[model samples]
Target: MEITVHSSKSVKPDYGDSSNGDAAFASADVVPLSVFDKVNYDEYIFYVYAFHPPSPPTTVLVPALAKTLAEYREWAGRFGVDGSGNPAIVLSDAGARFIEATAATEFAGSVKLLTTGDKVLSLYPICDGAEELLLVQATRFRCGSLVLGFTMHHKVADGPGMWNFMVAWGQVTRGVAIDPVPVHDRTSLFARQRQDSPAQVKFEHRGAEFKPRAGGEIPGVSCGNVAVHADGEEVVVHRVHFTREWITELKSRASSNRGGAWSCTTLQCVAAHLWRSVTEARGLGAREATRIRVAVNGRARMKNPPVPEGYTGSVVLWAWPATTARELLRRPLRYAVELISREVARTDDAYFWSFVDFASSGAVERERLVPTADAAEVPPCTNVDVDCLLAIPFAKLDFGCGPPFFFRPGYSPAPVAGAIYVLKSFEGDGGVDAYVPLFSRTMDAFKKSCYSLTPPMADARL
Candidate 1:
């Protein structure tokens, strides 16, 4: 399990092409953080993809990375602030950090390397600073396997945005023109420009994305981003696989009690299943209130001037669905599915604009609010937090080499919070892959009930 670093350097974008030259982004050019991006200013997302040895060499890969950055200039930019002191990305072409490393062992025997903590994390570059918006590490094994790891600040882009960037990079590596050029205009796409009073807004913005001020706490409820873990607890990021057939059956079971009126979507069914199983695993009291935070994309949901297809920025919000353990577990699966569906159904254009309006009202800065991810830490299994990334075309991320055999976070975010990231499995079996982090104490219970699609009998113990 030995890893040796061979080289590390900043790869600046190559603006050789006059069409999109570096002059477009002067040293002072900056992109202000949108309302969606501001909330994730303190967060960083990590990912790792494994490829077989016949992978492209650094000679081809590094240049492709720099060429790709020319188009994705924002990634090579550094963090800064605008005149009003709001968070912004200074497009100064500061360059992204890239490293080349070698591993002493084979990829198959590297399971221990993927266990947890600093071991697997070593594969990715450290992005806990403002100097670099994107950091990448390429680790090569003796058997010709390569592990590509990268980290990006959440404020720069969310899951969908990152996917767009990665797919473009892959296209560049293969010597193809990047299809569907990225749209960097976040202000107009996600921010509200029209003048509007906070009182005119429909939904209550306080205590949702922004933390409420004095005397605004929700009695006993915690923020959606709040997660608490036991002292010295061992958290493991485990994969829970749900085959296509399993999901189909689960959908059937969830809609069985609905009398054919409506059926739950794939995510709704899967999320409900996860929430119920995690609640049982935690062994929460029957009366204890538990909630699941589901992430909803706002790209297609926005209208007027609909969000462009390739807008690269964070535009996602959470849909919080809550119920007592007794009700969530005792009721039919459809009950939990419906609760989630209702929330997601309502989180549309109006809801997104309302949130934008709240931010535009200066309330976010006035209240000195902090996002839940920046709030008190907790275990993810304590309350399920689900983000579905199934639509990300991971299989199509070919870089002259074959598609990646595996794609996952370089390291689990278990230490910070317990969470689940659902992605498409690389097995080509149409199975769903859920990257879940749970405390060792409840891992066994979760594994036992994770695949069970049916609701337990009212009197049955999990």
Candidate 2:
């Protein structure tokens, strides 16, 4: 129930030698962060790994504890990204200024930590001029359980890339063969000078309206960039659990509604249902326009030569699906499901190529992106973001002990128009994790809304 923090331990990868002794590969002096890594890129990534029921008590020499820390230090260094203690990401006339990555680890204690499977999130990555690219926190609980969490700057790597590195680290912890090594070839995403790609050329002409921010661009946040806030307004995170059985029921309902003409994936089905429910809860007019913004991973979708499987840095973009609330709610859930699918399908190799060109335009990109995340008030149109947790692979991260009991993304404080995060369910249960954050009034009504009591929801909020 109580937690106390101590001094932080800075894990500076020996820049001279990436591997202090034994490492995955030889390190480089600096790994250039790709343009994608800078878009709306949150300075810090908050992730938690739950390893409960502590490895049965074992007798170990005092030196073993220190040795484990030393080993972890070396293991953690492998991800410091070319051994930079921190990330240098401020843009300046001098070809973009960057700072070192202070990726350090922390120690804490709790009496009731890991007693329950509730997912708690906090942004631990420091953002002030004094920043740490990555900060690992180890919390010891009275129950002898542990939750290994870390916050890393998005400048280093995005979710998918970060998790892949975690998986490889787990393999090393177990002394097993690691899978695809982490690749730092950011040039794969760099824009071309030839302007030969058709999609890239087309993207250059699209009006600014189609971009992220009206006049701003992506990820060019200020030194003290913070979540947009409102006067006396608040945002809260809620873990809305969807059971496997319920997802099946929704799919079945969707199939039935389609007269067995078509079927949708669990995500599409759930996304459709929530899209309608959230719209209704907001008390919006039936004919009000609503849209869903989804983050798309372009790693495998790249054309010709795709980004390597274990490529480092961010490889993501957004896909939008919009329709009037009346249209969305009036039609069967299948309609929205199809719409979401169609918009998502639009993201491919060509789309990514187009994105690089769009972002490379510089100031226009910044003009279009900042307003979306920084505007004092949201536009009249209702836009909700849906985050797919599968991309992060939280459940599969095992550090020689076992898979996590629970995992969740860091808390998001975006001004509460609304956002939905879909993640794998807790250990067992065979369900899904939907971390939804909305305006207070909307959530209050949502909990008691008919949607929560319906068959698809299984009448539970776990």
Top lDDT: which candidate number? 1
Question: What are the RMSDs of all candidates, in order?
Answer: 4.4, 7.9
In model 2, the Cα lDDT at residue 311 comes to 72
Best-matching candidate per TM-score? 1
lDDT of 2 by residue, 173-212 (tens): 5545545655655654465735455435354323222434
TM-score of 2: 0.74
**Per-model C-alpha lDDT, please?**
0.76, 0.55
Which residue window of length 10 is worst by lDDT in model 2? Answer: 91-100
Provide the lDDT at 239 for model 1: 75
Model 2 residue-pair collision total: 20
Could you tell me every candidate's TM-score relative to the true structure? Answer: 0.89, 0.74
